[model samples]
Target: MKKILSITLMMLAFAAGTSAQQLEKLFEKYMEDERFNYVYQKKPGMVERLNDAGSPDLWVFEKSNASLGRRMLTLNGGEKSLEESFTREVETALKADKYEQVSIVRNGKNRVETYEKITDQGIAKVNFIKNPGNIMVTLNLYAQKK
Candidate 1:
């Protein structure tokens, strides 16, 4: 009975690992998508010193309601092209991941787009915005394991 239980536990672990791996690959694909790369060329974690060398524009933070917490490292600003192409890329990535377009608001030159995906782990949300001068992107993963 003990041996059987051990095997079951191992299988469960493997299944969880596979799910995580698939999630990661999807993220990488989203990043590598030509539409995304064409607009924001900088890779994640490449700090930039811009206009008078202000604080690093890129930042990420994560918090959980438990003894375990996660860290979110995000990229803030980068090269920007036509707003039309960038928005298309955003929609493509989100839709491919099965995230429903939650909302999109436009206030003149500024616009915000939100997408949410329901997964076994929890809700995965992504926010994308474009202003007259720069674009902002953030990813939020809730109830995720590891």
Candidate 2:
């Protein structure tokens, strides 16, 4: 009986690990680009910075809710609001009939929020986790360009 119990426990652990791995794989397929240099999460804000090699003055920062699933894209030195950029991107993409299958959801129990951008660029996804203290956050960035 003890041996059987031990075997069951081992199987359960393996299954959990496999699930986590699958989640990570899915997330990877949804990130923006590989050129992003800095990704940091602070209180109430999560920032992802990317540099445009062709135009040094053009810097993009994706800022989103550290807790909720709301997100916005901003030009670092530009006068435009991040929210406006976010809206414009969505509108343009929709008008061009680019992204039609994208979806987003928040899992309260796991404290994880996922965003899946399904387009010709492939699926770009992000996962955010809130730690026990509710003060620290872990963000998994995944984007497939082309």
Candidate 3:
């Protein structure tokens, strides 16, 4: 019985890790879907620098350190079935990843939520925005500023 419990625990831990990585897989899976729009940045520094130089007040990433990279996936004007399915998948991944919900803002038909997960290197932030006909998920990775 003890051995069985130990194996079960290990399996659960492995599943959690895999689910966390599913978020990235989710992005890759839908990136080329005609129903979605995708944007990826290898180095988000240029945009961060521009934001810092232009509007210091709006540059909040500094609080996390420096921007290492960013990826955004947008689902726009899709069928109700597809939208529902995508939403479910995103929610499942977030829950499995154990990301802490940092903030949520609701304005009329639009809702924006932020989640953060701490890593050894730094922090990973996700911004999820949903409107009546649109859903956007943005993942931002930050590294410790040297």
Please give each candidate's TM-score: 0.45, 0.26, 0.83
Off by over 4 Å in 3: 1-6, 52-60
Candidate order, lDDT descending: 3, 1, 2
In terms of lDDT, the poorest run of 10 residues in model 1 is 65-74
lDDT of 2 by residue, 21-133 (tens): 44333224323533212233332332324321233432222322112222322223333353344334434433343223333344653344434444333333443332222
Q: In model 2, which runs have C-alpha deviations exceeding 4 angstroms?
A: 27-139, 142-146
Looking at model 1, the pairs that clash are none
Q: Is candidate 1 or candidate 2 better by TM-score?
A: 1
Models sorted by TM-score, best on top: 3, 1, 2
- Cα lDDT tens digits, model 1, 31-51, are 654434322323222232122
User: What is the per-residue lDDT of model 3 for residues 62-133, given as tens digits with 9 covering 90 to 100?
Assistant: 653777888999999988888888988888878877788999999998999999999888888899898878
RMSD to true structure for each model, in Å: 10.2, 18.1, 2.6
Which one wins on TM-score?
3
